[model samples]
Target: MDAFGDGNFEQSEIDPAAEFLAREQNALAGLEDEIPPLPTGPVDDDVTQPKAEDGNDDFSGYTVPKQVTEEPERIRKWREEQKTRLEEKDREEERKKEELREQARKELEDWYKHHEEAISKTKAANRESAKNAEKQFVAETDEIEPGTEWERIAKLCDFNPKTNKSSKDISRMRSIILQLKQNPISTNKKV
Candidate 1:
């Protein structure tokens, strides 16, 4: 008979819940044959060979053996050696850094020495140029005529016309000349 009371029941029309339960029961039956029976008494704590109370066969326990808590001597020695090697490496790096710093200092000093030499040379050349200009001015003044304007200006500057040499106040004389040139007094004016 079919589920709905019609005599047309088909194997493909079976209930899915009943089919699932049948499959589960068959799987459980197969697992029962493959599974070993559990021990009836207290299991031994030994990992290598666990002894059951019934004395069936040798079996190893799942628990791991207790390890020694102390650190080994060889491992400690190796760690100390590694620490020393790292310290030595750090010292070597510091030494190299110091050497680099010293080298940079020397290079800077050399550059400064060259820079100072260049400045000194420029200063010496400028002094030489100034001296040459002064000598040229002296030569021109020495050839001045007795009654000329240049001779008059030289007398006003405290220069010895016969010796053709200026006094110690040559800077002051130059300043006076510069001022007279900038603002000249009329020669035809009556004082």
Candidate 2:
């Protein structure tokens, strides 16, 4: 506390933001006094300036200048809109594809249903035809009499001759009896 000056020099240091603002003000003041040189050659069309042919000093025909450091809000909004449009198109395409898949699935199921119905109808027709054939075969076989050449084999096989059309076993016996009637030599063989 016995020093010649106050020990508070560190607290008096200037803020960095204030120093920067002071420098920026001095630079702007210097630019105000000086005049910018006119471009010699043909100026680029993209710069924000009035047309030389119009000779007007107002802001007409002057496009807003773009900064190299920052993007405008309009471009960002346009980009978002484009992205949304593309996503919507993709969703629509996916929905169409799903619809096509559903249509194909329905068609396949219908085809299977029709095929099953056709198969059932064909099976019923086959059964009817088989029953008709069996009836025709039985009618043709009824012409063979009891005491004909069929009786000899029926006697050897211990079967009754009067009941030839009685049961399934008798029907099979009648078929064997008819085969024996055709082949005379096998009739003498024992069962």
Candidate 3:
């Protein structure tokens, strides 16, 4: 406590360096007394002894037993059989997956065939209805006189403006007549 306090009061002086040196010397002297003395005779190399490597002497003299290092004949045969069974199982799984994929492909083809047939039937019905409507439109317009409003529209529908010949796009003429019939305009009325 006095080492860290203010220097206003007088305190006894203590030398930490001398005390640390004294402790280290006592520890060295104790270690010297516990150490064993070295032999003064000739060394022999015939006797087998364990050697310490990297300061680790726990497994220096240890040896693996022969029974633990080599497997028995029965266990070896069992391991080979297990490997063969696993290969066969993998081949069977792949075959099952291929069969499932083939079945799914066939089902998809059947669905597409049925759907195409239904679509073709619907398109044929629509074409038949359009042809019947065009015949009915021609029959109604044929009765109008040459100087009438319906007669002028029928004559215009008979020829293409750009080619001055018979029109090929009869659907467009039919749509125009359909629109005129749905909403008739009065020529004598004033806005």
Candidate 4:
């Protein structure tokens, strides 16, 4: 029928340009149909009134209350109360610190007392051990005779064997022999 070879092109009576123009006219007419007119009345004063103390706090009416300040006496009283509260808090902290210091002092005293007792016990034990050692030394030296090692040690320690009797000689000889044993090199050189 035409260059595209479509048979409906010849039979159809639809004009695309005319159809598009008709749809545009219909849409434009719908947009203009029955638009509401703009308001023309005076605004009511009640809607713009400020809030009253009667509890109607809607945003349609907003009001700012006056700024109020306390009296000088009331402010002074409040400051005093705040100071008292702070002082009480400080006193409480100080009391706790004092209690801690007292506890620490008591603990230190206990430790010192225990240490003193331990030192006293140790000194007593050491004295007992020394006495036992001296007795044992005397007992050991009691068996020595004229030409023995104890006699030689006694002579070396500036003690005369002739003048010293058995009871006195034994203790003196034991001390001298102990000294000689402690310093063997010096005693050996002397001998």
The candidate maximizing lDDT is 2
The CA lDDT of each predicted structure is 0.72, 0.73, 0.71, 0.70
Model 3 residue runs over 4 Å out of place are: 1-68, 143-185, 189-191
Q: What are the TM-scores, per candidate, against the unseen true structure? A: 0.36, 0.37, 0.40, 0.36
lDDT (C-alpha) at residue 67 in model 1: 52
What is candidate 3's local distance difference test score?
A: 0.71
lDDT of 3 by residue, 28-133 (tens): 9878768665443443454333446777766444433233357899999999999999999999999999999999999999999999999999999999998998
Better of 2 and 3 by lDDT: 2
Colliding residue pairs in candidate 1 = none
> Candidate 4 residues 32-91, lDDT tens each?
657654333443443334554788756343433345666799789999999999999999
What's the best-to-worst order under lDDT? 2, 1, 3, 4
- Window of ten residues with lowest summed lDDT in model 2: 59-68
Backbone clashes, each candidate = 0, 0, 0, 0
TM-score preference between candidates 3 and 4, better one: 3
The lDDT, on a scale of 0 to 1, for candidate 1 is: 0.72
Q: Please, what are the lDDT tens digits per residue for candidate 2 over residues 1-191?
A: 73858776465588999999999998799786586555545446656665556686665443544456666899989999999999999999999999999999999999999999999999999999999978976775686554455554454464565655564556575676667666654344577
